[model samples]
Structures are given as C-alpha cells and as structure tokens.
Target: MTTVAFVLAGIAALIHVYIFRLESLAWTDPKTRAVFGTTAETAEVTKPLAYNQGFYNLFLAIIAVIGIAVGAFGSASSDDVSTALIHAACGSMVAAALVLATSDSSKLRGAVIQGVAPALAILALLLS
Candidate 1:
C-alpha cells in the first residue's frame, strides 16, 4: 500500500510538473494555447498569471516528490513526517481541483485531470 500510494503520488507530481512547464514556459506557444483553448493574444496577455499559477503547481509537485523520497528512502523514524507531507500535498491538490471545478463548469475536465491521481493516492494511503 505504501508503494502504491507513493507511485500514485509520483504520477500526480509528474502531471503537475508538466502543467507547470506548459503554463510557465509555454503559455503563449501555439500548441499550449491550443491545448488550453486560449487565443494567442489571450495567452500572451495572461502569461504573467499563468507563470505564477505554474509555480504553485510546481511547488505542490515538489512537496509530493519530497514525500515520496522520504517515504521510500528515508529512515523509518521519518515515516510520520513523510506521511504528513504526502497528506498535505495531496490534500492541497484536491482542494485546488475542487475549486477549479466549482469555479467553472467548463473546467471540469481540467479539474479531473489535476485531481484524480492525488485523490487516488490519498485513498491508497488511507487504506494502507
């Protein structure tokens, strides 16, 4: 169960990292704009906002990665710290997704994309 939890958390972290890259580094790129359903002008205008939001995602991913590393490789004494980190990171990810979903119905897909893995990871951890 621990392994399953960590793996799912890792997957969620990777997704967030990709999101960070898209929003922070490629928000105005044609492909990124297409994926986000934004016009080039809109993407350009919103680039600063996206960059800031991207860092938020990056930070969450980093937290989750830290949890995974501590849980998998750190001494047994650190288990509580590892669990706390994972719970906090995954919980925040879930909350952000819920906010996105509630803020706009059209963003449902994006919310699901952002939340599912973290939700699963949380479930796995709880069950474990």
Candidate 2:
C-alpha cells in the first residue's frame, strides 16, 4: 500500500511538472494557448501570471518528489517526516483542484486533471 501511494504520488508529481512546463515555458505558444483555451493576446497578457503559477506547480512537484525519495530511501527514523511531507503536498494539490472546480464550471475538467493522481495517492497513503 505504501508503494502504491508512492507510485501515485510520483505520477501526480510528474503531472504537475508537465503543467509547469506548459504554463511557464510554453504559455505564449500556439499549442499551449489552444490547450489553455486562450487566444494569443490573452496568453500574452497572462504570461506573467501563468509563469508564477507554473512555479507553484513546480514547487509542489519538487516537494512530492522529495517526499517519495525520503520515504523510499531514507532510514526508518525518517518515515514520519516523509509521510507528513507527502500528505502535505498531495493535500494541497487536492485542495487546489477543488478550488478550481468550484470556481468555474468550465474548469471542472482541468480540476480533475490536476487532482486525480494526488487524490488517489492520499487515499493509498491512508490505507497504508
């Protein structure tokens, strides 16, 4: 169960990293704009905001990855800290998704995309 939790957390972390790339690195690109349902002008105008948001995602991914590494490789003495880090990271991801979903009906799909793996990871961790 702990392994399952870590795997799901890893997937969630990877997804957030990809999101970071899309929002930070490719916000102005046509493909990224289309994925975000933004016009070129809107994308350009929002580039700064997206860049900041992307960093948040990246930070969350980093936290999750670190938690996974600690949990998998660290001494047993560190288990509690690793679990807390994973829980914090995944919980924040889920909360952000819930906010997104509630903020706009159209954003439900995006929220799901952002939330699922983290939610699963949390559940798995609880089971463990």
Clashing pairs in 1: none
Candidate 2, residue 81: lDDT: 82
RMSD of each: 0.8, 0.7
**Whole-structure CA lDDT of model 1:** 0.94
Counted clashes in each candidate structure = 0, 0
Tens digits of per-residue lDDT, candidate 2, 1-128, equal 99999999999999999999999999999989877889999998999999999999999999999999999999999888889989999999999999999998888998999999999999999999
CA RMSD (A), model 1: 0.8
TM-score of each: 0.97, 0.98
